[model samples]
Target chain A: MFDTSTFIRLLPELILLVTALVVIFVDLYARRRTALGLLPGLSIVGLALSFLAVFAQWGTREVVAQTLAADTFAAFFKMVAAVAVILVVLASVRYMRARTRYVGEFYAFLLVATLAVYIAVSARDLITLYLGLETLSIVSYVLTGFLRDDKRSNEAAIKYFLYGAVASAIMLYGFSLLYGVTGTTDLQEIARRLLNGDVLVNMEWLAWPAIVLVTVGFAFKASLVPFHQWAPDAYEGAPTPVTMFLSTVSKATGFAVMARMFLVAMPALQSSWTALLYGLAVLTMTLGNLIALRQTSVKRMLAYSSIAHAGFILMGLVAVTTALGQPFNGLDGVLMYVVAYAFTNAGAFAVVAAVEDGTGGATLDHFAGLVGRAPFLAAAMLIFLLSLAGVPPLAGFAAKLFVFAPVVRQEYYVLAVVALINAVLAAGYYLKVVKQMFFVEEPERAPFAVARSMRWALWLMIIAVFGVGIFMNWFAFMASQGAAGMLGL
Target chain B: MVPLSWYLTVAALLFVLGLYGVLSRRNAVAILMGVELMLNAVNINLIAFWRYTRPDNVAGLVFAIIVLTVAAAEAAVGLALFIALYRLRETVNVDEIDLLKG
Candidate 1:
């Protein structure tokens, strides 16, 4: 029954796997020749090819051997992951070459990370899911410490590894419990068993612990409150490009998996799970914003703000319901919000990377008089900051409107108001960066030079932020379709 | 045949001990050991459930094998990170690696 179409359907993942292998081998042989410059070009081509593959598979939905699926939902995330990886690779080109000796391996790891995201998002079986998640996590740890000799990078990697291992172990234990009770490792099968009221009748008491343990793992990945200790250290310590990847793609991957697992499997426990998420959503936003407001370092502030954004995204999850009629009503908002966030956050971090490269510092003091040093970067940072603050005519505003629409529709007035206030509180820190860039007096040095590749990446992101905002209806429709496809609507 | 409750009880105890180790231990390696203990508990749960529920299917056995492999990989990464930490600060104690604290 396995046909050529099966392989064809997995073209994006296959292309990514081959690209990673090629990049790895190319690094060893390229040496210090002019050929070294071609590595990034090849990686970009690989990402583009995969993006096309996802496009080709856009409307096709099929489960392959009960382990993975080639559905519109997977396609949607594949495109997101592809865009994020491409932007990160573009940002890394000059940055990685300037810092690290192993340029080829950096690009290779980026591709592998993207490949892992595809696998994780497409996984239909629990084993496949775990494998994908671990692959992504491990690669991410390696990427975080790519600057091996730097103490900060090393510390970030270890802290991330320890926290990640413990969290995944806990989540796996919860998975084992679920498999033990339901006697199936397939996600859809687990849902069937639990919701049908046949398998978990006598074992109803076990379900709560299983869900709680699993949420711990997901919360860590999403960097939600109470499990958010790693974000600031990891974001500040890693190379800025890797931080961009972690903040945007890594966070999106976590949300994608979380949405799939909670909405698809064990949805029968919605009442209990939603209540828990309600509390977590509030804690994550409030704590993240309060802590962010006190941060001095710009990078650490962005890290904390990312956590707060995670809380806002969780509001979409809380708005979800499995009442059999309104499928994916809130989920569409989650997908749109994450995609919009990827553009805005990645664009913002790209600016940080550019400034750090120019000034050798990422502190607010170093950012003083940036308007005179680099006018384009200052303007771009303003765009991204305004977008993050949810100003109109920007992607962040559109993202908030889409996600909060569902919450308001569901009559979650308190949650929506809390999120609104956090957004306002968040603007204070974002404005600090803008104030440093625009309002401070000019430094005496020659104008700082922006790398050609870094400039391109920022421009692309600027386009994406404004493009998605202006084309809100089309992207929102695509997100709704992706959400509907995920639920088999 | 061993009772399912007995296996589950031991697994729960192992998991609890692992959580305690992860929480209370200051040394990085010891905390990793705690994580290992927790993963081992999961393996026991998976295998016990498989043998008791349905031995014909190999999914449980397969899942346990994957978990074992991933655990080994995780340990290798963990140790590598610890070594990197030691090279930087001359210590593997988590409390000592506090340079990035807010």
Candidate 2:
């Protein structure tokens, strides 16, 4: 059951698992406050190394033990997860230091959670997939409530846990139905059986229910509409760094898993699910943007905006339609969108974390006249906000271009038009934040200093946003290659 | 010999009842218990399917075992969250834990 090739294939995950264990041990011994600095340092080193391991495995494709698959698609998302976690840890150094005492578990769980995402995206078996999802969910619940003293944090964690448990239970029930119908937990095997009509002839009616039930779990994870109530509360209540991770890395994982499940395992049921996703996509974007228009708190507004972005990404999936073994451009668009979004959303939340550190407020008024106090931060936030609004020459605009191009190419005019309206609605809210930071004036407090690690993280995110924006052709090509590899095209 | 449909019917009823409990209950612990009931229903479905359809294969059995293990872990985390909520707000009522809104 075990072999050397499997170990080699999982080198990145192995390094992360080892690093997580070491962080726990390090935390236990480093009781002094000064020694706490080493934890985040070690965590970053671990993440960077894990990133290198993934890079080394590029272009390698193999399935380990009929459960985990190592391929470029998994490698691409591993890099995204690693980069997001590194940025979150860097941003967290000062934020967590200022708020809580359990610094070690915070860093350790970050590594563990990153590892879980790797497992999740690579899973080819239902058992492995479920375990990876639960691991990510559990670690996230703890991380959300890291500040035990904060009532908001505690309440957020409770809500997240309650919602998470029920969602997972429902998903498990779906898995059971699927397993019963197919008689195997291997995803590809199930696909083979369903495609060859070995299973469907006897159980055709069960397929739609199974697909709908499975979508419920994924929709919850991705914060799709009607299943998205927990997002704003969890995002607003959690620590800003955790909020950054949740919006970017956590959401990216959901999309990654959703793409894999739909494109790889259940291609037989594509027509029905794509139609379902079309309706969900329209509702998610409209509701997410319209509600964000009324939010007073900047954090809560970003939370809703993240939901709207989820809708944008979902648009790519809804447009996917393959024939004659040719790969769908919609999947390529989705892959690019996920990478671009990881940087943009994380960068936006990092700015919020820095501002929260400077002033203990999170409302729109807190950002007034920000340009005067911190020009670099305000400039960076401006770029991120513009990018999010899909302004030209930014990552968000590039991402939106890639996603909508395929929908238009496929002659999906109605989806394209609805998306255009949603884009305009999204810009309205994002521009309001820009107006507060640049135009509105409040000159009462002294200029504040951003922490060293936070500054470095912000610069890295700024570079990524521009780099992806300017080199759109190169990144799009890479994303398409990864998407093609996923489909074995 | 019992038919497969009977087991599925009972499990579906249990799952529906659990879902109703989860949606209607206000107390956090009670909601967690509802989640537990839902998981148990899943376990029954898994075992029943395994015995009737795939008696020669071990995948279904292993899946049920994993589900049981994961459900316990989920309960532990849920209870810990409830205890944390109690310590913060002096009550485990989910409705009262609304420090965040709109």
Candidate 3:
């Protein structure tokens, strides 16, 4: 009875696995000079194909024998992950060649990481989730230090590894506690047992520890305040393309897992967890922005800014819990914010990479008079910065508004007001970058040229930022629909 | 049979020791060892829980195995990074690498 049905259901993962192994072989055999060039192309094609396969499974809901779930929520995230990989690959082609030596492994690891994200989103059981998250974390550790000769890269990789390992361990411990209490690892079965109060009444003392440990694990991945010390150093030290991938894809996957676990499986404990999330949201936003203001290095600044944005997303999660006893329409804001962030953050990093390629600069001062030299690059940066600051007529504004509207509806006036204040504080740093780009005089060096590939990615991201910003309603609808599907609404 | 509290207390001690290693050690390799110890503590917890609460469920066992596999992979990559760092900087002192420091 347990034939190839599981493999069939996981067709996308199967294809990706085969492709990753094949890519390794190809990298080993291909000519050294051409390997880097061909490998990214191969990765892009594989990711595209996997995306199509995931789409083919859309609207289908089935438990793949208790380990994985084929559902619309998974399909939606699969599409997002695929798109993120495509963009990262596109942006990486030039950056990797210029900076990194082992391009083959870099591309291969990225593909594997994307596959891990797919698995994480599709996981139906705690074991599968752990396996998937570990896969992603391991590959990312390798990729973070891909520049073997760079000191910064080495340090970043170590810190990331140490933190990630500890977090995973804590998470596993929590999973064990839950298994002890519920006698099941499948999310649905655990939920059923908990709702029936069979486990809750019997093992009430274990619940708080389990919740705290699991929250710590998820918080590390999401880069919440106390656990976020590694993010800035890691982001600044890793290669730019890797930073983009970490901020967007890695962070989004954390949210996906959190939504799946807390919203679906542990809805019974909303009151306890919501308080924790609220504290994290406030601390993450305030600390992230306040520290970012003093940074001179653009990469480090963005790293802190990304942390602040994580806080914003956490606010949406808080809204989802506060508005109702369950995560429902409130999740729409988080989803929309994520989509907007994916575009804007990726675009910002792409522009940073482009500038770095040209001027060998990664500091804010290096961008002085950038507007006079590279108008398009400066313009792209402006759009991304504005969107990030939550300015009107930009995707960021819409996202913030969408999240706050629900909080208002739920009459959480204080939370909404705090979020608004944080948004204003965030503007201070975003504008500093903009001012440096346009107001200062260009240094007396020849202007750097943006690569064709980089230009194409930037243009696409700009269009996405604006398109999502202007048609806010459409995105809100899609996000709400997706959230409903996740909740089985 | 070991009491569940004993297992939990041992796991907790291991985790705290690991945490101390991670925060106090300056050498990257020592820090990695700390991380490994923590991971082992977690594995013990998983097995203990499986035996005590869900004797009928195999998922905890499966998860512990998976966690071991991932820890090994992580160690390989982490050591590679250390090797790379040692080559570049000629030292492994965490405090010395301050290029990206705030």
| Top DockQ hit | 2
Task: Give the B-chain TM-score of model 1.
Answer: 0.97
- The residue-by-residue lDDT of candidate 2 on B10-100, one tens digit each, is 9999999999999999998999889999998999999998999889999989999999998888788778877877777789988888789
Q: What's each prediction's TM-score?
A: 0.98, 0.98, 0.95
lDDT of 1 by residue, A368-442 (tens): 888999999999999999998888888888889887888888899999999999999999999988998888886
Worst 10 residues of 2 chain A by lDDT: A319-328
Q: Ranking by TM-score, best first?
A: 2, 1, 3
Tens digits of per-residue lDDT, candidate 1, B1-102, equal 777889999999999999999999999999999999999999999999899886888889999999999999989988988988888888999998877878
Per-residue accuracy of model 2 over A1-489 as CA lDDT, tens digit each: 678888888889998999888889988876657458788988898999999988888888899878888988888889999999999999999999889888888999999999999999899888999999889999999999888889998888888888888988888888888888888899888888778777723555676788888888888889999889999999999999999999988888888888888888789888888998999999999999999999999999999999999999999998776644443488888888998889999999999999999988889988999999988889999999989988878899889998998899788899899999999998898899999999998888678889999999999999999988999998888887777768877
TM-score of chain A of 2: 0.98
Interface CA root-mean-square deviation for model 2: 1.2
Model 1 residue pairs with clashes: none
Candidate 3 lDDT tens digits, A360-408: 8789877888998899999999999999998879999888887887778
Q: Which portions of model 2 show Cα errors greater than 4 Å?
A: A200-202, A324-328
Model 2 is docked with a DockQ of 0.82
Docking class of 1: high
User: Considering only chain A, what is the TM-score of each predicted structure?
Assistant: 0.98, 0.98, 0.96
